[model samples]
Target: MAGREIVLAEKIDLHLCWEGKQLYLKPIPTFLLHHDFFTHAICTAAAPPGSTTASSDLYASACGFLKSYTKLIRHESDLAIAQEKNLIPASVTWNQWCDFSADIVLNTTGMILSQRYDYGELRLTRLNLLYEMHACEPFHWGDHRYKFLLDTISHEWLLFTFVYFTVVLTAMQAVLATQYGAGSVGIQRAAFGCGVFVLVVAGGSCVLMGVFVWLRAYVLFFSETWIGRQQYRIYYLDRILEALVLSE
Candidate 1:
């Protein structure tokens, strides 16, 4: 809580690195470090080595805060402001700050001030942050051209195919009309019935295609959410282990 204590906490050599989209926290290995009496007391109060009994819920809540916090931080200036407000540490860059803050808080207080903040306020904050991040990034049309082309074809292909078939059917009807000379009533009736059957088949095919697309999208969404939850659980366990090692 005091400035001296905060400074001491910062003195611990901790670093964050990214491997793909996953973050890893590196600390001085346990065998190479010497701990003082005060450090031992702090670590004991935080959590026991190899156990997260007291810190489990706190760590989970802190992780949610860290993720939302990380998403909001997009620039050096934003990071500076967060540091000024003591929301994050001054020692790290924006990219490295979230894990550091989470590590420090979970090891010390196991509490976040934002936990008391309103949900609506947090949602609005995240929305504003997202807009700012999007606005700051440069958009390149060339990078998205392939995606645009694919989407266009996906949305219009059914209509285009239907139009092609309709044109062919119309040409066939015109030929029948000319050949029959408008006097063969039975042939005309048979031709009309065949055309109706073709229309029915085409409409059924379109309906089936629509249902298939909807199901595919639903499955993809469900799979992504399940995978994301699993990844987050792994990340949380890793962070807890890293904190335990550092405390040692």
Candidate 2:
């Protein structure tokens, strides 16, 4: 009974692990990567290979992952962790290595592809969009307010045109009210109402726009503590953005 309970608990843990990471996508992530579970799994004895070939032959399925890592791996720590010196005891067999690599590459890709628009794809799309807008990495290394303001202000001619049009319209309405209002009260009231409506709409829009900019700016620069600073970043400001993607 005790043995059965222990087995059940482990199976539950394993299920939880896979379930947690069944969706999120990120670079070099794995289910048990860097966890004590990983250490325990590696410490277990690996079954012997079918052939008499050297252990290197076991890595046939994992060669693709190795090639990709060799070419695109950005972090030296990843390489260091996979070294033979660090993988003592039972170490990782070819099966384990393949599983690890699959979890990082294939599983992540599959999850992203299977996800709905508002889920994984949405977050990844957001991340990519932000990546294009960013001048540098880490996503929070610089002040982006100037860039946004300058980018918008670059279209100042349009705003100037709108303002000029509104001013002229208001002036014309004033003329209509003063010159023709007594002759036709309806025309005068219509002109005055039109001018007031336009002003109110335009002014309200400007105020709302300004408020939106101010709020976004505040959010961008928020976070007093070091941990708070990571809230917006560290996986693209989405829930579970860091949940499993931050692993490995």
Candidate 3:
């Protein structure tokens, strides 16, 4: 019989090796480059025999990729809003919604393209998205407050975006530091920059986490508002109820 081939599917597990120990985690999607996955796949499929290459081909592919990322982000953004509003389950598998979100960072376009070029394309693109998400996700909280304890949280797409970037950057920086001398100026600078990036990321995470915690705790323990005769309803809720009551 001909030798059997093992084909990796869109989903795979991430394994971490430490001190000869292996840790296998949940299933994650392979990197599809969202917008560029098909384009790149086609290009690679039809790639000219190392003979005909054009800058336009690369640029066109990149533009397509960006469009794809935007589309995916928009889709995820909507889903996150829905989830926050308690329209979806908090434990819903990310992969169940978007394969792109479920993909493991290491398997993404950045890794595949890294060796072929001077730099990795997917990773950089991801970082750009991540930076935007990190800076913007917190503001969404103000817009998505629930009427009560069971109300959904909004802007979760932003949270996952941050998580993926954090994981990727941390791994990349650690590898660079370990493989290259940690004391070397280049490594030190890279590490420092990575540190700052991570600090900002961590700060964002903390803010979001804190907001959720506060909202949940406040809803559970405190009366809604003190401005009304009801005396027990939240202030915002009382106002809303009053408006409804008067509208009749």
What are the runs in model 2 whose C-alpha is more than 4 Å off?
A: 1-144, 149-171, 174-182, 223-248
Which parts of model 3 are misplaced by more than 4 Å? Answer: 1-152, 177-183, 208-228, 231-248
Which pairs of residues have clashing backbones in candidate 2? none
Q: Which candidate is the best by TM-score?
A: 1
lDDT against the true structure, per candidate, is 0.47, 0.41, 0.43
lDDT of 1: 0.47
Model 1 collision count: 0
- What are the candidates' C-alpha RMSDs? 19.0, 18.4, 21.9
Residues 173-218, candidate 2, lDDT per residue (tens digit)? 6677574655887777767777787778778867876786675445
TM-score of each predicted structure versus truth: 0.33, 0.32, 0.26
Scored against the true structure, residue 27 in model 1 reaches a CA lDDT of 26
By lDDT rank, best first, the candidates go: 1, 3, 2
Candidate 1 lowest-lDDT run of ten: 1-10
Ranking by TM-score: 1, 2, 3
> Model 1 segments beyond 4 Å from truth?
1-164, 172-181, 244-248
